[model samples]
Target: MQEFKEREKQEQTISSPLSESLYENLRRIRTVFQTSHDVVIRELRIGEDKNIPIVIVYTDGLASSQSVSGFILDALLVHTPKVEGVHNPEKLFELMSTSILAGGEVKPLSDFEKLYLAVLAGETVVLLDGCAKALMVSTRGWKDRGVQEPTVQTVIRGPREAFSESLRTNTALVRRRVKDENLHCEQQAIGRITKTDIAVMYIEGIANEKIVKELFERLERIDTDGILESGYIEEFIQDSYLTPFPLTYNTERPDVVAGGLLEGRVAILVDGTPFALLVPVLFGQFFQSAEDYYQRSMIATAIRLLRYVCFFIALLAPSLYIAATTFHQEMLPTQLLISLASQREGIPFPAFVEALIMELTFEILREAGIRMPRPMGQAISIVGALVVGQAAVEAGFVSAAMVIVVSITAISTFVFPSYEMAIPIRVLRFLMMLLAASFGLFGITMGLLGMVLHLCSLRSFGAPYMAPFSPIRLAGQKDMIFRLPHWSLRKRPAMISKENPVRDATPAPAPPRPEGEQS
Candidate 1:
């Protein structure tokens, strides 16, 4: 922490305009970049006499070598000698910017802060002998993971391309999908030291102005040393920090971001991370997937409803089993009760302790599977669970029924389309189990009510977290738990696109009228 403050102070002290003297400028540059072996400073002489002094400063391996050799160096050394009136430093700088370095994107930079930003961002900076301003040319060419298939959010029918680590590449992917003049991408530098680039994207007229303004205000208020991923920005800008539920949605797919922008939601794309963040997320949004739109409406609706059912099963399965066996034994059938009693005759722990043991074991296996190598992960999780559960059942540690309940709950948790939403469910399941252990069915009911009330009270960028359910918007319901036919979804969700509510106007399809029937 103290090092960060010292670095900040050093940067502040050097934030001044560049000098016209070439030697003095070189001294200051060397002072700032002392001991940085990768900082390449190439001195060159331009013009007919070959005495016009200039220095090229860039970081090796960041700025493309081919571009520097072919376009910049060749232009200054070979092409400028034939031109006339090149002795004056101001005229030389103008000629080089306008006619010499014609192949590259060049910008005039005056202050040291701007110069350092351009150079560190993989661009070449040229300082003339007697000119106050320097030329910054874009030549970034670092190794990157080219566009690859989605890993976490895999979809069978949607586009196979996903966002890459490069900010420009990610933006271009979205641009390719949403080709509209109103698709606005505003860029800003976040992180005091990292200077990580972030783009705030939304449609101009379709997005709510208030939401956009608020988002900008929140981003501007963030003060940090470094932003490693979109998650950092999400944490800094989220409405509440106490809740486990994620207020912002993140995805690696560009189609998801493009879809969000069309719905008037803002997207934040951070550099050095593939995941992009969508703001003002709702509870229902996590249940819907990109495949929901690709498939037929009825099938999508059925799948979406199944996800909601799975959500409850994942949340309440263990708690219900604990409650039934410990407090409400009469709820079970007589025959089943006898079998369960026979199985638990020799067990030492009570129902709650038994369930907690199995739950913790399963959770440990799940995390191990994720952290281990891919080939061993699946094998370890599957084989370990089967062996441990069987041994425990045979040794009178837990009943077979408990193993079945835990397995079902684990499977249901994997059914969620958004993993962020599933995480909160996993956490709440433990709380629900505790409630059921203490108060049985009544405690479970009270927990449900409290969870629903909390969801209703939560807000994502001032939009209701449980929108269209707590607020009960009829228009938004068409695409909530049940995705209606495409033609029926003619308007965007409330508060998202109030500026331009209507999205689609096409009516439902019908067979063409046969042979001129009389009206």
Candidate 2:
């Protein structure tokens, strides 16, 4: 028994050296980054005679400089008198907790993994020689863009404040709207190299837990080196990698994110990006906006209907023109057909070729207008309209009717609230044009059918993308194509309502009239 005990003691001693060496090696490996602003090391002598040296290390950018200077540095170097026993890591942590100057907890550096995490969180670390643990001080300060009005999603009557680049700031913006305690935000660090912090927020009781779980699972599977923008994360986690249509919806407005959460959806907010991702998005969701809810129901409905009309115009105008002129001439009114034929009398190219030429030119000009500086953008648009429309007609390059159709189509595409949603329509416009030229109205019908079928097949987190239309949920029809009065919208969307059936407690009764009033 005595011999066994000695052998056990020797084994422990042998392992102790390796552990110590491992810790030392890790510390050295961390320093190799040689990032000047990061990896700051501070040496402190607590007392005049204690002879105890304290080394503080932290990534400069990740930590608050003011807090470190005013609290940790001021307290350790100037306020407290150095004592021999105060050199220990536990003692340091306890001292910090009690001292008003520190304002945060101090942890052991021997918890080196946590030390690295602390550095990432903008905390400073203090290392004491001959001590098993290191003292980590909270001091993280970084500058970020202030919340401002969303440039892209401007509203005439709604909250002007938009989400900022900071995840915490963005989440807080959302939290301000929803004061419910059930609103939960889960944080995860994504990107192997950038270590970007991504936050997933949703209402616990209202949001679909299964959908949220799937969203998180897919996010965890992303194995990228860096997430420089929200687009990077969006493209990584989207359901259909090949589709031009965006599977995930993104917005810069905090109200939109909050609204999605209320509708039992999960929102992903990425650090350093203003755009927030909303999951389980349907085709119709892209058409709706915060403005839609804020405006009068009648006006909102009219606008939504107009947008729906615009979508068709954008997709079918050019194609319909090509079909009517090239293959379906007999279907057009005699006078209209005669006018169109007269306009194209001198045109050298076929109806399809003329339409393609005008469309390509318009697309190029549109792209140029967007890419150019703001001051020059308006000028480009004006010049493009006058030169492309008027000049092409006079030159006999394209028919006047074709020019009108293309212009209307281009204008209609702009009505879509979501830019991502509009992009697929733009691509589909060309395909429909080709089909119409080849097979007339029948081809257009087939193309529309194919699109509908594709949309029906798409599942946004297991909910039918074309819900309340394809599956035909009558309960959700109130809010599908038009905005119904708030009081009349008794039931929530059936797709998400499985998780949250009761949107309101009871129907609000009409206000009572005066006693003298008669029906």
Candidate 3:
């Protein structure tokens, strides 16, 4: 036991040296990974007469093989002449500084920090013997997913390009949309083990500095082992972890990110993930899409109202049906009530039990449909619906009306523009169903009241979740449920623009026609 404990302690105490001799550290790394085939060390003899040996090291897949072979290796071997009895790090760096390509730079190998950073960025490091300097070649090329339309948030008429996994590419995309000089991008590497790159972007003049500072402070406090996705960072920085509602909004479109930046919001882009997270996000923001402002105000407002209505219908339709059938039969038409009772007569389970079973089955099928391949997804959904609805109803497991109600509810949930916002509604739907099953309409009213209370109390980045509506900002109501004309909306969202309220100049009236033929 003592020997094992000592061994465990030794293993746990293992740490990498931040400032050790370059050759010694390289030797240690080589010793640790002995017999590993991926680690390649290429020895280059420079200065034809002197034959100074330089070692170029890189990982296989992480670094570009073609660029290294064509540009770096050939440049060092053929272009660089052998030097005689030269061992100065500065002199060697100076020589290679002029030898390499435009983007590549040579520095001291003793600067191990920069060396590691270059390696992580897919560059090959060249180390010369007796010299403490290294030359880092920019050969950073790897397989990345092509820029395509975002699958989650598809629009009819808008920019189709979406962010890729590469953080540089994502930043470039956003930069292309916003040419403003005030747009700032600050980067930090998080995750104790993963060391994932995270970039925080916002407009310097538009975004609140206090909020940006708070976001940075919160992110710096995270001490996790890995952050493979943006969701991990979202949960880490959120004010309330237990709340079902999302405090941050996520998007793949650069235009959406740019729009949020212009509205004084911050965006967090994680490396190796296409989803970029937006901060200070409100409930209403999820319902409004970029395409909303692109179309006519009247059409946009109508569509927005329809989405809000569908949200409620999706959450409470099936539950309301169950409540009415089980305890509030008087509310329904007498003939319709009689028909429902006759259909449910042969079913073994109560309305609640039948509803729960159907809902659970539907949820399972939905999950399966999403996980299946694209070609087979539609087939699976169709067959699953037939099996769960028609066949099950015919077998007397549930009534036909229950199937119809549940199907409509399922379809309505998809009307939501944001998936993050839709999750809470799905969860609340189950709770509402439970309440309705217990006490009918009264239970649903109580559930709804509780939900409203919770939403009113919720805050995103210290801003109210249900803003303009609950706070009774009548002036801001023009863009709440209904979008007014662009000229009419002269101010930004009050919650996000408490300091700079005015957005644009007042509209000027048209000049009078002096001598026109028609008045």
Candidate 4:
């Protein structure tokens, strides 16, 4: 069996090393990227009579061609100055890196794994004829989306700029907003094949050290073959995978992420996706928006209250209808009850069946509206509204009251400021409907209790998920469910920002007294 194994072909291990022989290293690199046509390895001779053999390796589309030509290739080949005397190839590498290279960024690499990573991350690598160390040149330039208005989590009053797919651009967006020297970004390359870039951002003194340490440990534990987007890392590192509620908040708006960082939350940014994930996400956070801080405190507070009301309405509207119509008719007003009964006169379905049908149909329509082409998506909405609102009732398939309930639930769901929060609520809404259908109002109450318990039991990066509500931390309630004036906000969240708790100085602001004679 051992002899047979020796005869069989083996895969190239990542531990493979470069050799002093120029041809040997070239053969190894080519063998590893055998089928990849995008790999470009250019060989040239330079230095002191153009006798030195050097090779530059980079991916064709990933590295900027203009940079390679203008900064690297021209400097090494055409404009290279002649040295007085020749030396060992190792010394030649030193001379070329220090004296000959004109690239903006240059670093030396001795390990093959790091060299490979640098090249794959859109950099250029230079190898000498008789040297083991390679020079990694920063030539990253690829066509990516420019900073544009955020499609999701948009704000009407705040800055319109949004994060792009590139990791550096996204981090820069946050940096531009915060402009604090204490803001730090730690990077890690995840995934075995994809090697996606992940940046952990937090305020150095404000962010909880325990949470940052735990976050790094969890990220290091991920052993996946590939991570395509932020959602991939999100699922791998979240508190609980079984719970329906999201333990992390994700957004495409950089201002929102910067605000979260200021509040002592850590932000995780993944390569190739615009959305950045924030940890220690509280239940009240989903109802808050970046626009809240831009507007007057009173207006923001009223809107925030409306959002909380809408959340309950979306979560319990269908279930309440099912329970009241199926088991407890006395809870509803008689006039409303008579109107609903009159609408359900010809419908043969029970309250539970009717709710389930309408809710499921609306979900299907919602999916269709989002998945279809943009022009067709709008058409899907029109068709869905007509079919669900008028056609279904006229066809005697569902009662008008049932359609109205489902419509209200769907509209209320849109009131949530964050779609990630709405996702769990959407799935839980169906579960709540089922419980109410089975046990009426008691079952609904039991479902609500279980949800609260689950939320209380959950934690986000070692901090409470239902913070300021379950444990009743009064200090953290300044901005919960209402917007206090920024000057009145005197402290950071005690749960997360333990090190430097005070956010503002003493002597809170007050309305100025009119000019009067003072004693």
Best by lDDT: 1
**How many pairs collide in each candidate, listed in order?**
0, 10, 12, 0
TM-score of each: 0.97, 0.90, 0.90, 0.95
Candidate 1 CA-lDDT value: 0.91
State the TM-score for model 1: 0.97
Which lDDT tens digits does candidate 1 get at residues 278-352?
988998999999999999999999999999999999999999999999999999999999988998899988988
Which candidate, 2 or 4, would have the higher TM-score against the true structure? Answer: 4
Kindly report which residue stretches of model 1 are placed more than 4 angstroms away from their true locations once superposed: 1-9, 81-84, 516-519
lDDT of model 4 at position 422: 83
Best prediction by TM-score: 1
Cα shift from native, residue 18, model 3 (Å) = 8.2
The runs of at least 3 residues in candidate 3 whose Cα sits more than 4 Å from the true structure, single-residue gaps closed, are 1-25, 32-36, 81-87, 98-101, 104-114, 499-502, 506-519
- Candidate 3, residues 461-502, lDDT tens digits: the string is 877888887787887788878988888888777787554666
Candidate lDDT scores, in order, read 0.91, 0.80, 0.81, 0.87
**lDDT by residue for model 2 (1-519), tens:** 999998666444423421233246345535544555556766565655747566666777777878888877777767775555565555654565467247476645555455566667777776655555656676766888789989988889999999888888999999999999999989998876677899999898788888888888889899988898899988887777766677889999999998888888889999998999988788898888789899989999999999889989999999998998888889999999888888889899999999999899989898898999988987998798778789889888888888888888988988898998889999999999999999999999999999888888887778888898879888787887889888777756778647766676667668899999997
> Which 10-residue window in model 1 sums to the lowest lDDT?
79-88
Question: Residue 265 lDDT in model 3?
Answer: 89
Better of 1 and 4 by TM-score: 1
